[model samples]
Target: MIELAAIATEQRNPRSRHIDQVSTEEMVRIINREDHLAASAVEAIIPDIAKAIDLISGHLHDGGRLFYVGSGTSGRLGVLDAAECPPTYSTGPDLVQGLIAGGESAMFRAREGAEDDESLGKKDLLDKGLTEKDVVVGLSASGRTPYVIGALTFARQRGAATIAIDCSPHSPVGACSDIDLCAMTGPEVITGSTRMKAGTAQKMILNMLSTGTMIRLGKVYGNLMVDVKATNHKLEERARRIVMTASGCSRDEAIRALGQSKGQAKPAIVMLLLHISYEEAQKRLQAADGFISRTLTTASTEKGIR
Candidate 1:
């Protein structure tokens, strides 16, 4: 079957004629206009996004990780989303993973003709020991990338929950996955240059997926990032500030407790809130399922607080 994305590429739009001749201001306007459509495309798919999120929340509660697979621009977007989860949610490296076609080498230099190989996708999933309990999200702008479709098919065979994110409805990728999130971003400004509009839509949707999943996993408290890891100097500083702000501790007190906890933001927050030593705070957190809010509330009541 001819893929919609490939067919789109074969299309000719008069608006695209002499695109090279457009003035700088007109080019920016046209691009911006096309970009604006991305939001509407995303908005139309919020129900699908929420469905995926609910599934992810349930999977994580049962100790499953989130998995993403893609090729080309879609692959890069998946990788980008997976990379942000750890710092954003204090999750271990295993909690969120992204696999790109052609492996890690494809991240920089495009591996010519690699995305067309379906076996490569199947092998990549098998290499990862993809299990029935995890979630698999395949990203492809055209919704029919052989690689993505193959991965989705393999995921179903393994009993994993499957999802497809693509730009076309009734796509081969959509047919294979359990959940399909099709966002129609229309023709690209540059006429079938999916790296433009479709790519942007996919990136936006993935961002929403990961962010929503993290929030459901309790990574966010109100509007604050409550589970961020203090892994670097700047992050350590931000952790101190967040702890200080959350527990209303003095700078010295927050810094001391943060040091006591070895720069672990959540434990230090508990330490300040409960006025407990770091070790006690650590034990409390472990007992409370690692939620700082719950740990602090329990400790405060145990100590006869309001």
Candidate 2:
């Protein structure tokens, strides 16, 4: 059996040995000080994060999907990121998915015991009909969770691109992945409570991985969320603002273009910028594989166009 004491995450913090005796103010200060370590640890693995982003973008561009699988807090984090992709980037529901060890119900409540069953991980991926072109990311702070290990192994055997994010180096999940992202956010302020520093690092890393992938996929234009789905009044207003900012048009012009483009910010901006019909701008965007920049480049190159 693996010794828990040898694991950095499970090891006791020498400085926090007397945390129980500290005043509330001192406790909060100590916790805040330790929190910076998580971000620092994540900074060290940026190269790996960049590589994973590139890989994920390539597969997604080729009509593949991205999947996140984990258990407990890790699982919840995965689900949270996956759920945000649709509204944030205008991606389809099938584009990115999250699977937890104990299934969807696990997100609301803790299912710690479900993580021990390795076969459930494989079954979940199979249930989703995982394809060879898909990318599967396994998240496990301890790096030894059987559920995540099984998911990565199944992904590898099926020719899917596999990525492992963990807090421990040379983790079991990392060994099965095409790329390993180990943030090495050591022991928690409360000893073995990985929900602290380790979870923070994992969440930060997930933000980078998914946001970078979407940016690379052309969901962003000039740092603006051009592909944002205006599902609500707030988002619709934001979309109009994005069009105005991108096209340097008045609010009235942006509103007209958005109406013509059926609330799509990218095409609306393209229509305003190129003085073209909304339909033509949309066709160009589609032909350019949804890349507004590329479509604009082509439109500019066309002699006496529009």
Candidate 3:
């Protein structure tokens, strides 16, 4: 029988027993205490995370895709971040892709033993036609998931840039990748249960990495999501408010500009900033590559030159 076939596949920390029989109130307090360790673990890895960011930002600036590969909770986190990119920053879905171990089917229901197959990991990446220009980020809390390790190894063979995220500083996942982020959250309250503190740290790091990249890509302006897509009612209202808040215009004026720009927050902002017609605003934005700062800078520069 496969050794893992009969096991629960979860690591239990020996220390958990000391608290398992404790009062309910204490259980929560213990969990919360464990949670604090996650931040510090991430704090220790900031320099390494920054290194990945610097490399990723450079790759993306050259027209490369940022691919996230993971399993279970990590996979879900990647997919969540990738899905939000389009609506939050008006980026194409193709720009940020998430690959889960069991594919889309695993998103809703857990697939049996999906994370144990290392070959599947390599195939999933190869199927996407990952090239040298693409960057693949493999996430595994234990830093020993066969699926994640296999992906990193495959990426290296293909000359693609690879990054790994794991909780243990001595994790195999860290050793295999070019940029390994070992957050070092320590032993879980429940022993090997990484879904607790380790998961939180991974989520925070992923957010930092992706958010920082978006900023450098010019998706944000002065801390605002200037390029948000107003696809739903809530977002449409937000788009109106973004323009109104930025331009200090009446709600009606903001709504009008948003409608004229097809509910694109950045283009609407440009229209207000230049006091120009929607057509001219859009043309200018296109020239500036949808960057609000650049759009505004070019307009001010041109006016001065004239």
Give the clashing pairs for model 1.
none
Tell me the TM-score of each prediction against the true structure: 0.91, 0.97, 0.91
Candidate 3 clashing pairs, residues 3+ apart or interchain = 13-190, 13-191
Q: How would you order the candidates by lDDT, starting with the best?
A: 2, 1, 3
Candidate with the larger TM-score of 2 and 3: 2
Judge candidate 2 at residue 187 and give its lDDT.
84
- Residue 2 miss distance in model 1 (angstroms): 0.7
Candidate 1 vs 2: which has more lDDT: 2
Q: Please report, in order, the local distance difference test score of every candidate based on alpha carbons.
A: 0.83, 0.92, 0.82
lDDT of 2 by residue, 107-196 (tens): 998988999988989999998899899999999998999999988999998999999999988889999899999999888899999989
**What is the C-alpha lDDT profile of model 1 across 1-306, one tens digit per residue?**
784436543344455566678898887877898788888999999998999999987888789878899988889889988998888678889888999998888889887488898888889989989888899999988887888888888999999999999987778888998789998887777776778888999999988888888777766655667688878888878887888788888889888888898878777887777778889987987787676777767876877953
Residue 48 Cα positional deviation in candidate 2, in Å, after optimal superposition? 0.7
Residue range 140-213, candidate 3, lDDT tens digits: 88677788888888988988889998876656677878898888776778755667888899899999988888
Backbone clash total for model 3 is 2
- What is the Å distance of residue 174 in model 1 from its true position? 1.3
lDDT winner = 2
User: Could you give me the TM-score of model 2 versus the true structure?
Assistant: 0.97
